[model samples]
Structure formats: structure tokens, C-alpha cells
Target: MLTDSHTHLYLKNFENDIDIVIQEAKKEGINRFILPNIDETTINKLIDLHKRYKNITYPLIGLHPCSVNKNYPKQIEKLFQKVKNTQFIGIGEIGIDLHWDKTLIEEQKSAFRTQIQWAKKLEIPIVIHCRKAFNEIYTILKEENVKDVGGIFHCFSGTIKEAEKIIDLGFLLGIGGVITFKNSNLSNIIKDIPIEKIVLETDAPYLAPHPMRGHRNEPKYLSIIAKQIASIKSIDIHKIAEITSKNIDNLFFKKNQNII
Candidate 1:
């Protein structure tokens, strides 16, 4: 019943041993993987991977903030059409990131606003990717949803106050490998945020947890994350798994379980 709330299961890193990875994770009690699409280019591969493991893998589609280039209008157009024409559980991996290039802040904001609109119209959660731009993302969300749209702040790295803001917005904080890092104070942050307001993710092929911190991440490693949260919250690992899986199912599967 464990769920990896966010993962890129179809990435190139899993090309050679994708089946092995998924099968091992399945054996480890990782029952479900919520796949977040990078862009239009990766949508087909994401879908192909989902088809192979349809019972466990779910798909979320959106334009990543990092991919918000000069021609994002054209890209968003294609993604918007896909979202409207196709059936996905949610719109995800979307938001503002001023870490890479602050010059494109406005462009990223525009894409975020547009996607938020789509999420509202479709009545689904919007998974956000915020980096060094929490204020901007929060402002946009507040301006858009007075009651707030449910979603995940993927790879969430923020203060307790910021975490509270996300919770108030009816969103969940996506806990990932960064929490397992030696110097990360995320454990302390999570100590305050209730487990109900949190979700699990690997962001695979990117952020790997301890012992495998420098290597490619897989859903099997989700066990380690659950264990970490257990230690942080002074609860059992199974409890962590049960709560996070329940929260994720309530967030995504409850919306459109069959479509994904």
C-alpha cells in the first residue's frame, strides 16, 4: 500500500533496467508510483511506461518551470491541449524556479498562472516545483485560489512557516531525498508539519537518498524515505507508509483513479 507520490519512472537512466527497478520496488511494498511528466517530449515515454505497469503507475501532465523557455507559449499550447484532450490524474511539476535563470522569472510565472488556471478549470490538483521563488509561487496561488487548489509542492525545501502556508493552501509538501542528506535540516522542518500534510517522492534519476545519494534514485528507495520520516516523527515506518499512501490516494486516486 506504499505510494511514491512523485517519480519520473520513464527517464533514460532507467532505460536498461527499468523492469528490474519497478519489479524490485514492487517487491519492496512500493505499490504505486505517481509519474510526473517533464514536458511534451517525455509524455509519450511516460505513458508507455505507465501502460507497462498500469496497475501501479499513474501519470500527471504539465510544463515544468525549468522548461519554460522563450517559446513556452507554443509548448504550453501543446501541453494544454494534451491535458484537455487526454485523461491525467493531475497537472504537475509546474511552478516558478528562479534558481537557474532569474531573467525568465516572468515567463515562468506566466506559465505557472496559465497552468493554475487549467488546474482550476479541470478541478484537479497542481503539483508545483518551486526553487528560490517561494514568495512568487505563494503570491500566485493566493491570487488565484481564495480557497486554494490541492496539489503537491514537489521537492519542497522551505521553512516551517512556508510549510504552514502550503498546508493552508490545501497542498501537501513533497518530501524527497534532500531530507536524507547529512546536512539537511528538513527532518526538523518535518517535525512540525503533520504527516497528513505531507507526501512521498523520489524524483527518480535525480535525488537519491542516503548511501545512494550520488546515484540514480528508484522507487524501492522510497522505503528509506518512509523510514526517515518515521524516525523524524517518532513513529513506526509502517505508520509512515500507511499515512503517506493514504494521503496520496486521497489527493490523486480519489480524484480520477481510473483515468490515470
Candidate 2:
């Protein structure tokens, strides 16, 4: 089976026919969908989806870096309450993003650090969302000495050197639709990196792959991503699926596959 390691099935884009979307994905062998939480607002929706599809969907919780603001302390408190109250696969969609605005850079760092601490305390992996702030993120991660709890760098778009650094720091490169872009350098990086250090994701409702590019993305498109990787690495599609799925299982579902 294929796994879309990072997606937001709780988003409104799937509101109209989420069951159909999920069913279609299952039909295509994209059975496991890892749902990453954005903020407090989507917590219930994420949990509800997990409850409804207990065996197929895994839920991750965190305050997305983009949502980090002056009131982040309060937000973090609320998030902690939820983290303590539920069973989550990981802590995620958290990190630094300077593309949209840099005014909240400090706040984002604070939030990221707090969540990293939480992940370490909880003994769970993290799902990172990094964009235009790799250097800053790497600095904090290094300073915090957060090596025990690893995670995926969701929607990775970095140089091979950066990718290597992240792997050394105990994180996997999350490959998604961007790798299939005509001018993308991801294919080259994929060729260089070991498949074991990689993970598949859709970041669905965004970053749709080619042919499906410029359109909405979903878990079903993950097969296309697996195919792309197979071609890039010159490995069989089943091998890609098996190894990547095993990687996800190791990181997120090792102790309790039933929950995912």
C-alpha cells in the first residue's frame, strides 16, 4: 500500500465528499493517509476524521508555524491540553516560514521550540513545515539539541546538502508533487539519497503533481508520486511502496498500526 505521509483531509476542500475521496484513494492502493493538524481550530475535525476511519487515517497535532503569533503562548497551552488528552501519531506541521511574513519570526521560533520540547517529552516524531527559513530552523533544532525525536521535513524543497544535513539531524526528506515539476531539482536529490531516508506525501488540497498540476491534490495522487520516485531511483514501484510504507510504519505506526 502507498502512504501519503502529510495531508490535510480535514480541510474544507474535502468537505463535500471526503468519503468518496478516501474511497477512491483506497481503490488506488493509497490506503494510509497521515493527517497533519494546522492549529487549534482544526483539532476536532482531525480527531473526528480519525475516529471515522480508525484504521486508515493517522492524526498528528501541532500549532503550525504560520499560525504563530503574539498570543502563541495561549495557543500552545491549548494545544498542550489536547496533546495530553488524545493519542496522536506525532507533533507536526510546525517549524519556521519566512515566505509570508518575517514580523512574527521570533514568535514562530518560540512556538517551534515549545512544540519540539513537547514532542521530545511525549516521545513522538514531528512533522515539520519549513519554507524559506531552513537556516533559522536548522539553527534552533541544533541549539535545542533535538536529535532523539526525528520527523519528516514536509514538502522538502532544499539543496542536496541541506537534505543531507537534515538527515544527519535525524529527519527524513518529504517528497511530494514538487519533485515531479519539470524544472525541479528534487529528482536529482532523490537519485542521490537513499530511499530509506525519504517519505511520500501529498500535502493534499495543495502541491498537486504533474498532469494534475494547477489543480487540487488528494491522497489518490500519491501513486503518481510513487511512480515518479520509482522512475527516478530506477527501482520497482512495489519496492518504492514497500520501503516507503515500511519507513512510515517504523516512524509513525510501529507500536500501534491499528490506530493508524
C-alpha local distance difference test of each model: 0.87, 0.91
Model 1, stretches more than 4 Å misplaced?
A: 146-148, 257-260
lDDT tens digits, residues 165-260, model 1?
988988899999999999999999999888998888888988999989999899999888888999989988888888898888888768566753
Candidate 1, residue 33: the lDDT equals 90
For all predictions, the C-alpha RMSD in Å is 1.4, 1.1
Winner by TM-score: 2
Task: Give the range of the ten consecutive residues with the poorest summed lDDT in model 1.
Answer: 79-88
Q: What are the per-residue Cα lDDT tens digits for candidate 2 across 1-260? A: 89989989999999999999999999999988899999888989999999899888888989999888899999988877876667898998899999999999999999999999998888889999999999999999999787888899999999999999999998888999998999898898889999999999999999999989999999999999999999999999999999998899888777675665
TM-score result, candidate 2: 0.97
